[model samples]
Target: MTESKAPGAQSSYEARKPQTRGRTRENTPLRHNFWVDLKELIAIPDVASRLKPPPKTNKRLGLRKTAWCVFHQVVGHNIRNCLALGFQLDELVRGNFLKDYLQEPQGALTTAAPTEDQGHEVPIHGEINTIAGGFSGGCTVSQRKKYAKGVMIVETQGLDLTLEPDLVFTKTNLRDVVSHDNDPVVISMVTTGRKVHHILMDQGSSTDVMFWLTFNKLQLSLDQVRPYVGCLYDFAGYQVEVRGNIQLCTTFTSDAASRTANIKYLVINAPSAYNILLDRPALNRIRAVASSRHMKMKLPSLEGIVIPMKSNQKDSKRCYENSLKTKRGVCSVTIQPPGED
Candidate 1:
């Protein structure tokens, strides 16, 4: 029987034996060393970080150099506009590696230093309760940390504003006693070569608005207006229709200094006492501070000098009276139609 073994049968059995042996591989232990595992865990995040393309410069596009985020020393975008870095910062706060930046901007020094355990440096100049807050309260850490590392600060030729302590409102500021009320800080600002009066500086508003009639009076035509689809709410609790939008180089000046800003104004056809209103957007742009009690607004000029604008109390009162008269006239008008009694 042994000699009778089929010659081809042995070859077939050998082939089947290899397949049967392959199943035993399941019992073999996975080759994992402590060093290898540790190395792999450490290399995981680096692998992901490398997936992003490197930042580069193109001369043909006439583009500025790409901003480098100082927080992580990445070469692509600056800290001001980096969302990933912002998220990391927030995560650090959540992890208790850094203090929450929800406090007011006091005398706390906002300086960063290197730490032993942290992968990157963090602001360690002040305690959690004494940390200096940012200018805006919109996003807790977004705007405040924009220039946190002091790497995005740039020098521009025109109207480069620098906050000065002297700009703070004081009791000595000249204000009209006759126009004392909760009325907005109405001042005169030069826009498009016209000394626009009755311009209300409203911090509560989120936009800079220019009445349609005032836009026309500025010698600007409807064709110059860009198409804008937006709604505005008025004091009468009605949604005012927006006609269009126009960008004008608005200038605010004092005797010693002057600052100009390219203000984007939403043109709306609405009747109000103010010819134009400068709101939070414009205020933040110019770094201007308003003091309703002082009846004035102040900002840093191009030369870093404090520029102050005093409210036009007399014109304010006059405009208020005119608005009241207009309101009364509209109320007195009666419409009659032919009807069967």
Candidate 2:
């Protein structure tokens, strides 16, 4: 038997019916796009490379019937099938990282293939046939050879290529250089204890050249030169092999003082009237200043005195005439091999 209730008290079914008196409305749920957001985030250039693979336990999860892509965090794919890798590679190429590496030309890549002389095969940059073996997908000979070749190319680009500026000028030098000059400023210098005349002071040339006839007359032996197998091109667009470089002590003397430098002369087996061509290196070493108006050169001596060497105008004109004659005579001269000369 229950006690009698108060007049204000309500039953549970009667209270619920009053709360539900307002009619029920239609349900509108929001759409979840987790996979799409994840894909976009992974495709970001900076973020693509840093994305790591999912944990092994997550990879082996039974949630998906097939594999999963950790990058997109979606099923039915993996990191190997990632679409962001192609975009990242394209970005690297456009940014010049790949262009610089592929464009450098100084490095020599040698293949293991033997020649008739059993010499090391030099791999040309673009020729695929020069590879040691046929191209295939595996840890094969061709792949290893190519890998080694690439490594050598990268290693050769280090400190050996660095060069410093050679500034050889002074305030007091070239104070009276006049404009509109036509004469070539040629001077004399001592090479290997002998006075060498008709030495052309060529500011345009990049190398110190010694003609074969003059080099032979100087009595310099072949063994004294370090073998240089590179080619040198002249102003007339003629290409020839640089025989070698022989080091010599070149001296410039005047009434006041004298200067000496160990100059490396590139031996060129060619016909030229000039005995020696004093190019930028020798001039820079001596700190020489040339003046066509004055028809002389001022060089800094070891004793701190400036020595002025007078130019040989007569010899310069004679050499110019001789060179013209030689050029006219050999208009269609055949270039022979180095050994044939």
Best candidate, TM-score-wise?
1
Q: Lowest lDDT 10-mer window, candidate 1?
A: 329-338
TM-score per candidate, chains pooled:
0.47, 0.44
lDDT for each of the candidates? 0.54, 0.53
lDDT of 1 by residue, 1-341 (tens): 12332222211111011122121332221121122332242234432232232233322111113544443354434444333333333333333322323242223423233122122122223335311211222223343345454556665557533444357876577434444776557899898788988987766555677888798789997887887533344544455667877889999988978999998887877676778878777998988998877878998886678898888777767777777765421111111112222
| Candidate 2 segments exceeding 4 Å error | 1-181, 328-341
Q: List the residue pairs that clash in candidate 1.
A: none
Can you write out model 2's per-residue Cα lDDT over 50-132, one digit (the tens) per residue?
33333233332222336555543545444333333322323333333233333323233222222121111111133242111
Which prediction has the highest lDDT against the true structure? 1
